[model samples]
Target: MRAIVVERTGGPEVLAPADRADPVPGPGEVVIDVAAAGVNFIDIYHRSGHYKMPLPFTPGIEAAGTVTAVGPDVTGLSAGDLVASSDVRGAYAERAVIDADRAVPVPAALSAEDAAAAMLQGMTAHYLTHSTYAVQPGDTVLVHAAAGGMGLLLTQYVKLLGGRVIGTVSTPDKERLAREAGADEIVGYAGCAAAVRELTGGEGVPVVYDGVGKATFEDSLAALRRRGTLALYGAASGPVPPFDPARLAPSGSLFLTRPTLVHHIATREELTTRATDVLTRIARGELRLHIGRRYRLADARTAHEDLAGRRTTGKLLLLP
Candidate 1:
């Protein structure tokens, strides 16, 4: 077996692929022969020491593949079932262990690659639109990084719920992609604040999804109508600096929250429900996943370099 081990908190190069003993199923866990691993910005944070983890570990959180074995206490899943899972150990390898509670059966219609692509980004987008803000019909919302993985999914899902999406992107190519994903107005983020005002008739949207964080926080705060909500989920441009809560009142009396998927879908039932809804849409062709980059397990460094430099869009995957 081979695993991309994170020997230290440093650069992507620190993820060194080496032969290692294959992970075996423990009680309440299953061993998956991984076909794909989902690469996320959080992987970068772990590499950079922004998110602390025990050193000498594998650097992936999500994977999809065929189940080879299941441990005692595991039920509903059997060997040879195609599945996708998050909250797993050492997913960036030939084989990984998945907690039975966190594993979800992938739709039979979906390919292994597609299942892997949708698990993390799709779940995040689903929870953001349907759980965190719970956007309703006629709600005008803004999505930053709208060309990226979660951004595309969120835009489409929000529109499917009859809400309007104002998407911000760094380039014309991404702007085109965002529009294809149901973004009603695609704004070039160079003059984002002004563009947002124009798009909203100077009133701004009702909710701003700010994953770009420090780079777009102030403008995202500005691009909202009174009593609007700002869902700051990720900090791709770096974390938001400290601020005063009282400032929310002066800034259109806004509501702000930092939401994560773990908090929103804590229980096994909640996780399975959300995963089923999102995966059903994808399987039925109502929603689509764009896997913009693919890297072999050994090329994890190059993958991170491209992602950190914003050289890729949509979901990035590591084929094991």
Candidate 2:
């Protein structure tokens, strides 16, 4: 099997193409012939050592493909099953293994590319809106990086739940994309908090969905109504520095939370439920996934470069 191996953590240059023996299914696991792998910030974190991993490991965690073998103790799944998972091990390769319980059945209407693109970001958007800070009808919420993969999903999901979205974008193209995804109003990074205040008639929004971390942390707090929640999910520009909790008191007694997808899908039932909801919506044409670009498996370095530089919009996929 050909995979992107990281022998050391430093930069995207550390992601090297290498040949390895084919992965075999372990107990309670299934090996799939990977069709596509999702490129994400977490992969960048692993490559740059921001998130530690054992040396000489494959770099991806989400993919969709066809199951070719099942391990002992695994039932209800078999060869030829089309599955996708956000917890697959060594997903940046031609083949990967995942525990049966973590693999979600991809609906017949979705392609392998779409399934791979939707799992991690789709599920993340799901938990952020539905669990972290549930958006209520007539609620106006703020979404940062509203044209990126997670941003587009967050925008649409908020609209689906009957809320209006005020999105922040860096470029005209991104602003157009955000509006296409149902953003009610758009604002630039500069003076976004003031824009939010003026748009809401000085009331601000009920919640702010922030994935751009340090770059927008304080402003996200300022763009909220009194006692509103700030769901800080990702740090695309960089992680936010530690601050006093007392700061929240002056910021209208705001609530700040940093949530991850792992905690939301801690149980198999929760995992399947969330995955199914997102996939089914896609199948029914209610949710839309925007795949900005597809790179060959060996070009993983360029993919990371583009993503980390914020030069790409929508979901990125690696075709293996």
Candidate 3:
């Protein structure tokens, strides 16, 4: 099977297309004939050594496909079960062996590409809105990178909760997208978080969702009111600078949490429940997935380059 292998961490160019031996399922694993793979910020972090991983691995984390075989101890699934998974290895390939516990059945109304697009990012948006802080109606929230993959869906989710969404984007075009996603106000964050103070009448917001990391961490916390929450989900700009927790107290007695979907949806049941909520919304045409970029499986490097460069708007995928 062909897979994009990362032997050394550096940049997108480090990803080399290779034909490796086909993966065989281990106990509790299932081998999927991958039809689509989702590209994620974490994949880039893994590839660049920003997030440490053992050397020599495939980069993608999420994919959707058909099960070709199930491993020992796997049950309630069979060959030809249409499914999607997150937090798995070797997804950027023609076929991948993922833990059976991580795979969720796909809805008939959702296509492979759409399901792949929704799996990781959609669930992240779900858990972020549902668990991280449990956003409430009439609450004022600020979402950075509000035109990006999870941002668009999150904007909608926040709006659905009746929260006021103040989205920060880098460009005028993205501002329009944020508005369409139901953001109450869109601010330009070309490189700063001062807009938060401006957009919220100097009172700051109740929650600050910062995925831009290094560039926006401190300001994101500062943009919140006393006792508000600061949820940092990604680090596209770079890893956040070290800070004193005492600063959080003085800033506003703020709550800070760094969350990941894997931590939120730890088991098959949890994974299935969260995935169903997002997929059902998509199936109902309530949640929107903008598949902003598509690349052939062999073009994985290009996909990484665009994502790392912040040239992408929404979900990016690789199809074989």
User: What is the TM-score (0 to 1) of candidate 1?
Assistant: 0.98
Q: Write the per-residue lDDT of candidate 3 for residues 203-308, one digit (tens) a residue.
A: 8888888888888786788788889899999888988878788888888798988998888898767888899999999999999889898999889999988988
C-alpha lDDT score of every prediction, in listed order: 0.89, 0.96, 0.88
- Give the winner by lDDT: 1 or 3: 1
Best by TM-score: 2
Poorly placed runs, candidate 3 (over 4 Å): 190-194
- The order by descending TM-score is 2, 1, 3
Better of 1 and 2 by lDDT: 2
Candidate 3 is scored at a TM of 0.96
lDDT of 1 by residue, 69-127 (tens): 99999989999999997676888899999999899999888998998999888888888
Cα displacement (angstroms), candidate 3, residue 80, comes to 1.2
Q: Score every model by TM-score.
A: 0.98, 0.99, 0.96
lDDT of 2 at 313: 100
